[model samples]
Target: MTTRTSHVDTFARDRLPPPQWQPEFLFELPELQFPDRLNCATELLDRWVAQGQGERLCLQAPGGVRWTYADLQDRANRIAHVLVREMGLVPGNRVLLRAPNNPMMAACWFAVMKAGGIAVATMPLLRAKELGQIIDKAQVSHALCDAALAAELQLAAAQHPVLREIRYFHEETPQGLEAAMARQSPSFDNVHTAADDICLIAFTSGTTGVPKGTMHFHRDVMAVCACWPRHVLKARADDVFIGSPPLAFTFGLGGLLLFPMSIGACSVLLDKASPPMLLEAIPRFGATVLFTAPTSYRAMAAQAGQLRIGAPRGGSLRKCVSAGEALPVATRALWKEHTGIEMIDGIGSTEMLHIFISADEAHARPGATGTVVPGYQACVLDDEGRPVPPGTLGRLAVKGPTGCRYLADERQRQYVQHGWNLTGDAYIVDEDGYFHYQSRTDDLIVSAGYNIAAVEVEDCLLQHPAVAECGVIGVPDEQRGQIVKAFVVLREGHVPSQAMVRELQDFAKRTVAPYKYPRAIEFREQLPRTETGKLQQFKLRSV
Candidate 1:
């Protein structure tokens, strides 16, 4: 907190975690050394437009919707004007953003930053109950929601009046954002905010339990641009990025919007991103890079032979990125077998903002999550908080240009210890510095005193021809204390039967450790997943 804050409404800054709970940040790259007074929105958007890139294509939406850099800036600047002139927004005010991955959603997000307001983006599918929890937690002052998704937010605001104002986007109603933007001028003077001022509060996926608000600064957003995309991604200025991850989540926010914009590239936003929809949209939109979870990659791999993925082919597509869960060895190999383009697997959390441990196709090992991206340092730690030798499974701890900063929560002590961000992921770093993800620390299974990683069993299950998707969890048992159980969704033609379960169990025994086989197998039509496409094992344990 050495630098003076630019926040006029200082609720977010006032509620920041205590000094001792904040993790240490490292800015090794020149790009990370942001000036004391900075605004990320200007760095990502306004700078490019100023550098004579205004006419270049910047954002694309479904149904042939497209916006150049100049167009996006004009829209965002107008919205920023509306925020100040119409909505009565003040710097540092928390504003809720609710919408799918589209051009309008992106404009609203940038508008908040340009206006010096703290943006709290939420998943479009979040129900009234979940939305209310976030509003109360952040004391959100205003919201800009899509007309189609306004029902849930309206219901949430009724119950949680801490949310002061609500405005819909897209619709031409008098109170809608579009109508308000029509009245404001196109040009706006961007707010001067400190690099350390809080600009965004991203909530966790609530995979473990209650979601915590993770606060990130204006410089933290720019810091990621220097690390992952510059070092690991090596994205081209001409690349067109597209994915299914909602803009609310950091994964999608970086890949679909920030990363592309940083290099004057174009990004395509999808309204409907199912496997079939994505398969059709990828080629139709000529998207070069694809970002999604491993499950989605597995589904798309089934149709890879029929579609055209780039690099070796004539298609524009070239790279595929998988995150939000461990990338099974089977899924990685399948995509390469069908498309001739190796999939890039990485691990990141909302707290860290974007991918920290990742590798390009050239440096990526078969099943590893790859080395830590440049400008960041990671180590595997034992239960006593000491670094362990390579190849031993332990907690993954990282210190980098960006780290976790929970909003005034006591649990902040657990996330940051001794200046390191403990990501709660169990990983095994090899001698060559490649990190192999085992499972979530809490997801570790202890069967008969022998600890086993559920991801290993799930990876083995995925190799079977009949299994389409699966989630592995430890269930209580009297004999072994806890046994590994796998819930599998069979392929379309394969019917659920007793014989099929036996075959899959035997397949697991042959793949890895003989004792790691799932003793209990349950057939499911579909596995539960969060909006970001992460498997919700917490729900599985409850079931």
Candidate 2:
């Protein structure tokens, strides 16, 4: 929670060009003050509760379930009491939350926050091995999981003695979660929390095998909601936010959780959000504004105009935002032709938490990520850390209030260079000051919004005696955006077979997370190498 002023040496001060371009939009921001100490559950929600605004809906789902602002506050209060009185949850404890997107998951998130504890939201599809790494890394003591996901949670809990309690919630059962919900009073009081209190621990993939926990203070939550939503989405009381990003991701947390509630707006939760699910939910929930990746838009556009996925029956849908990967120009054109609305693409990372460079409809460049947001400053720098000229590709560096602080990891230096958050992206700025994403310099394979490491996968593959050498790279994928493809040189006597490929995959599943396993494999006699004997990934990329 300690706020420090950042100095960006990556920017070329002496050769800096004049500010000839500026973003076009009426940014009439209200004066905002982030408190020195904060608790997102108790502080931000309490402020809205005291406003006594009745009949304003806070959340709704595709299934026709709805909760008003008053209803939301009451549910959060009761859940907080359940965590405290029944579960024996105390301050400073870490609670692992594994569930799909639903009203109950949202309620549980706030309850964890209200109890002065840090909530670790995990993607529901994660297996026991992945869950164990996060539980061990974050030192999570208690877990609240959906009954469906409880099997995996139980498997993970069996490995660690510190994980004392694993509770399951099933909304449909008569004696299930509703029983727990019925026991607590709706008018329970909020816990008093300091501003610097840790509220959430988001895990991001490291270069090594395990993921690192990025801790955020309650003030960081409020800071992100106030600054990012103000600059990007600008939610109003009447707007409905609909998105496909999992709530476990910081992107989804900002869009689905913090932004909407900060303004008393409504959010639509989608449990099974594939392209078809998105097509079904957008109109079913009457979503006014949508948030998702460019890949989703591409998949929906493939359905042509038959889905009628945008804006519903009326012109209620005013905006659409895309992140996670570059918005291909062809994909953007397809969505515009199908829906008659431009899909705004932005670039963000787990390091900075949410989008900092974005394009609004008013001043959008179809292929370019627009100018920097108000509270942040960005620059493109060459290898020596000097600013490059317009139209030149270089490492993008940014400085802002919400920059990353790793959880006891040494790789922090690679990301935080000379006080600026050095993003892995290779990018360029045009004469108009618009930013364009190129590729990742560190070769971090991003498949479906998940950061994966090549060396980690190679390490796992090397464990097999048959593999002499292996290299992993991301190949273009239609659904996932990119998937891991492995190039392997087998041992002199060993031949590559379906059995060998399956063996390598199963080996990776045991050593690392399942998602990191290579989806495609190729056999070779020898790997192309440099004079220094380093494997030339570029040559493998060509094949």
Candidate 3:
């Protein structure tokens, strides 16, 4: 088995999670069955051009920046040649990718995958210290970075001896990626990699602590493309995807890049996407699908009345996907009230690669995230690792074509129990088989005898006009074992006064169970969030 593999640098394969700690994978759908030797880049990029659909736009940006399937494949192929012929990048070498969402960055990702190198993509916003951590952890040898974000990566390369080569893409130098690609042929034969070969080393967001590297196989990449987009999204060839999540994050990698490429659909890349920017671009660029977090959706919903959403001429936003964090019910209602598009909410983790549980526009429920996506099975498990009754709160465990595989981490055992991937989220399987997200298992607030999910209170608070953002946490209390405390960011017109606090407290009391209301509320100018837009509740509690 090892002799037939394509990888010459075996660092990623050597550090994979132990066999006993791995979760079971399910490939029930025929589309999920990939060949023993497959390169996902060929499936996503080359196949479309092979089918004579090369002229179709695959990627688009502002200022008339666009690339057809042929253009992207040519760029990717040339880049792949540059990696093997110029940089001496071995098949399994880890290439660190640091760039904002752009055409060339997408090409670099596909180029690495095509050359059989493990692509270790990182957020461009990461500083030198963070970059060094990933460099040291993944032992990344080569890097393809944007010129704008070169300072930190250069500093990281200087500190980490494992990083032997660093190449800049956007620089207009003789040593830049463009200059190197210009000399190479526009077509190259892709490496024949095993289906189980490590293709991507996606690092976690490290919202809790140090980030862990999650490795994925080539078949796993194609499985995500087949399951979510085919079953839940039902995306069409004419659909154009636009989003705020960075390509470094798996959510963005799937929604903004892979999923779109899988169907020959167009995806718009935004270097920086704010709510106003997305709303304005949707019309100018004719974006039919939007992918962002709950915070961005809440902000855009406030401006929805200012423009006609889903209108072909005025604005085109037919589908909206909400993830990264739990979606607030009030935020969902507000978005629909304004835009008339039911937001598709999903729950996914870095370990799982992309969304495993999601729903479409028609089947979307208000509070429930969704039913188990096709090609997957989910259940709520108690602490003893047994199935819990319906409507019972417990840990959410799922088995699918893609499962958790942390690279050389002890926490791998914690994430995978009973041969199932235990997504640290607390959820309930309803009587109708719908999964309801409550909170993170460790984030549930046990106040007195009542069990309170922090998001439920935060959702109620967001319904009030004054509330812009809020995070609920459990703090020590003398009376109750733990009291629900809220750190809130108010809207521009609302001041942080005792009167406003009382009004919010009373509003929460009226919204859900009285015990679930925040016992104390503190106002802030802003709340701390990870680069991916998930609220940092741990930071809130410390404050």
Candidate 4:
């Protein structure tokens, strides 16, 4: 593979970890092979149009705007022209993108890639402080953001000298990027980037309170599409993909954008994909595949009867994917009972780029994260980095076509050790070769000399009808090193009372081992969640 590029800003390339620190990449599958010179944007967008799928629907927004492959390519090409000719964006310059999951956000992402600029997509909900960290870390020179989401970006740019320019899109002002796109040529020859060229920088949620930028190559993006989607998802060209995770997150990036586009499928982009909005859109658009978190699935299952009004007869949803957090067994069972569809549970991380362990509908087990995707290799390893015995919980490690490459972060060495990406998740692989998630290594609760997975207690609580949502964590205790504490949100018509707590405690005791039941339960209006909807158990523990 070629190493050098025409990039003027080689900061990302220069700052990459030494070759010895990188995971051993495997492109053994025929589909995983790639040409030495490749630009992902050209393959995912332009190539589809060149192959006569130009008129095929690529994106359908909530406001009734539909864009075909050709439409997307044209918009992206024009945006690329504006970045180069007007903004002086050079190859490998980092470009920040901020917007909801809409057509233009996708266009901006493709445009940055097409122009050979690294695309750093930020979650729209991030504040100035959070955005400032990303801008400063990535050394972003330019930004293309939705007008509605520009306030924070502007504030972030004001604090960083490297962020020299910010361009707004879909704004009424003539100075907006849309205006520039309208004046430029629609056809663009994408920059000839190497397959290993850094194309995206996805930041972690900073559970440790310091975000790390995960660098992914162009081939990494194509690798994810070839692995998970080809093996587990097996989606078709006509499959209508819909999801709630923000595109900034790798889960949503793969599910809503890369996977669907790679298969020449269309996707429904919702600026706000709440349970009600997702439920309504599925029947209206005849969505065949849905992607969301376990929490959302549980919420929808509780309101399944009310969703029948506009839902397709026999249901248009053929597959449901749960990620961004561990999928609770109770949520999976409830979803299957309501929709007649098994929720496909998988485990992935921003560092690896997409889901590497998953099971197809035919093979999905209730509590397992599923088998490793075809192109990846996974194992549970102990502290010494040796593989743990089957059924023993240890750190989950994986290595394949895509792996961790944190930009200029010393933590890269900690994440990737002995040529494997230690994904921070604890798991156990059964004799049957299925992987079962235990908890994040930090989430393991050691109570009275017993290691209890927080998810286990939370899953048990979710089975109770009165519990709408809950997050379990370990709190300090003098007698016991730490004790299980659960923060719960009660369902409507359910009032919190000492009697109710006792009933829930008894219910959990019957469900799991008596010692695993939460010793302390606190009722709240709702649980803390990240922008992507993953439960903030760390926050609950702090409280």
Instruction: Report each candidate's C-alpha RMSD, comma-separated, in the order given.
Output: 10.0, 6.8, 9.9, 10.0
Highest TM-score among the candidates is held by which one?
2
- Report the number of clashing residue pairs per model: 0, 3, 0, 0
All candidates' lDDT scores?
Answer: 0.86, 0.76, 0.86, 0.86
TM-score of structure candidate 2:
0.87
Which regions of candidate 1 deviate over 4 angstroms? 205-208, 443-543
Give lDDT for model 4.
0.86
**Residue 521 miss distance in model 1 (angstroms):** 12
lDDT by residue for model 3 (407-449), tens: 8888898899989998888998899998998766666565542
Q: Over the stretch 365-479, how does candidate 2's per-residue lDDT look in tens digits?
A: 8779888877778899999889999999999988765666665656666777666778888999999889998888887888876778787788879988888999888898877
- Residues 1-543, candidate 4: write the lDDT tens digits: 465675778999999989888888888999998888788998899989999889999999876899999999999999999999999999999999999999999999999999999999988767776688889888989999999988777877888989987889889789988888889999998999988889999987433435689999998999998999898889999999998988988888899999999989999999998788888888888889999877678778856645542123266788888886667677788787777777788888889999999999899998899998999999999999999889998999999999999898888888899999998888999999999987667655655434466776787799999999998888866445568899989999999999999999998876655667899999999888999999987788677
Off by over 4 Å in 4: 1-3, 305-313, 443-543
Q: Which candidate order results from sorting by lDDT in descending order?
A: 3, 1, 4, 2
Residue range 257-370, candidate 1, lDDT tens digits: 999998999999997787788888888888999998776777787586567665665667799998876777887888887788888889888889999999999998888999
Instruction: In angstroms, give how far residue 107 of model 1 lies from its true place.
Output: 0.3
